[model samples]
Target: MKRSNCLIEVCEDFDCSSKRIKTSFIEGNNSSKMFRNTIWYRSLLDAEKSCLKEDKLKKIHYKFQDDKEMVEEYNVDTQVLLRRAWKVKGKLGGEGKWDVEIGDPMPDATPHIEGIGADFMESKDQPKLTRRNTRINLEWRIRNLPYPIETYSVSANNDERCIVIRTTNKKYFKRLQVPELDRLNLPIEQGNIQCSHSFNTLIIAYKKPQQLLDMDKEWYLELNRVKPIKDIPNDCKTQ
Candidate 1:
């Protein structure tokens, strides 16, 4: 028995980025080749309609599984794509061939299995915010030095309020637990901290600040004397 397959390409641009196209396949049945062809062809038409309604296709390319070359290509503006697909359906079974009984209509195409439909729907419904890739940086401070702390590490809890800092001098490590101030006036973005370590200091930057609460004005004032530098000079190279 011969196997039949259809490759349909729908793209917004010639490069085919922004979304992916999925291929459909059906095996030929010796007893009901015509019926299967009608079903598969109708399904392709339905899919094309769905893609058009969502503006997913600017160009579509179709090819058969056995053919090494593409069978047809169409621009969405013209009706030739659908017409050609229909013609291909008729050709699958010989001309004037009627496999089903007289007065019996062709059955409606079977619905595509779950998750097997075109990926156009997933791309269309994706959230705009989730697609955005943005990074944020946060500056913090520590005050009232007990020792000349050199090497520092910082991490935050899931709440974004509780922060842990570790300062090291030689072989000694001192850990400090800090909680966010109750009344913060400064804007804070919540995200994971990215740490850059140098011989004498560690600069921590937050990646996603939108999730964080405002920084405390009182806390900022108290730690102003030992605040971490918000901006690093471009000339200053650190390991």
Candidate 2:
């Protein structure tokens, strides 16, 4: 499969075209000069196309049978209603009144806790312990492919609202924080974090600004691509 990046502009916009993007890339990257770049994503137009089609939501109305005033009775936000209408978060509410199912009702505000990522020497009940499940518990993901993350610490402030993932390279240490939406898997607008161990990098991708309607086609201008991304770097100082 051919790998590439592109933008989708409204046809009315005279300055935008997929070919124009390719010509620019060819001029910049000598490595890709001879290869044919394929695949272009246009998100806006695709959304428009999808919206015009007949309702794709298959109305399975068994659960909402009991509630007569389903739509008027339920209290949900616009985003929540959209999710329910499409059955993305699971069929919620009742059968005919289809609602999106929610998990254990969490506090309206987000909750986050920090755990350690290192080794333990003696029988001390250290709060941070390393195990297979560490991957799931750890909030910060390290991506260091071309280089290595020597050591670091994670700090959260303002009731866990601000999170900083710091890494050291012996000579200097840099701190990268997790964005609010990324902390909870919430889509802000359109973006992704693509990790490739083979390439030794974790690519933080942003949606092509001009891509009008193709949501699937993204121009990942590698934000943070790293290799050998380990939970714990080899050189962690014992506390």
lDDT of 1 by residue, 1-239 (tens): 12222223332353354332311122222322232234333343343120112132222222334431111222334322211111223466553222211112233354545665655343522211101111223333222333343455555553545455655654333332221121222223334555554433334445433212212122123222332333432211110
Instruction: Quote the RMSD, in angstroms, for model 2.
Output: 21.4
State the displacement of the C-alpha of residue 66, model 1, in Å, after optimal TM-score superposition: 70
TM-score of each: 0.20, 0.17
What is candidate 2's lDDT per residue for 1-239, written digit by digit as tens?
12222323344244656678887888765433211222212211122110111123211111122222111111122111111121222256332222322111112232343455233333232212111111112122223434442343334333434333334554323333333233223333312222222233322222222221111112111101212222432111000
lDDT of each: 0.30, 0.25
Once model 2 is optimally superposed onto the true structure by TM-score, how far is the C-alpha of residue 236 displaced, in angstroms?
45
The parts of candidate 2 lying over 4 Å away from their true place are: 1-145, 170-199, 202-239
In TM-score terms, which candidate is top?
Answer: 1
Clashing pairs in 1: 184-216, 189-209, 190-209, 190-212
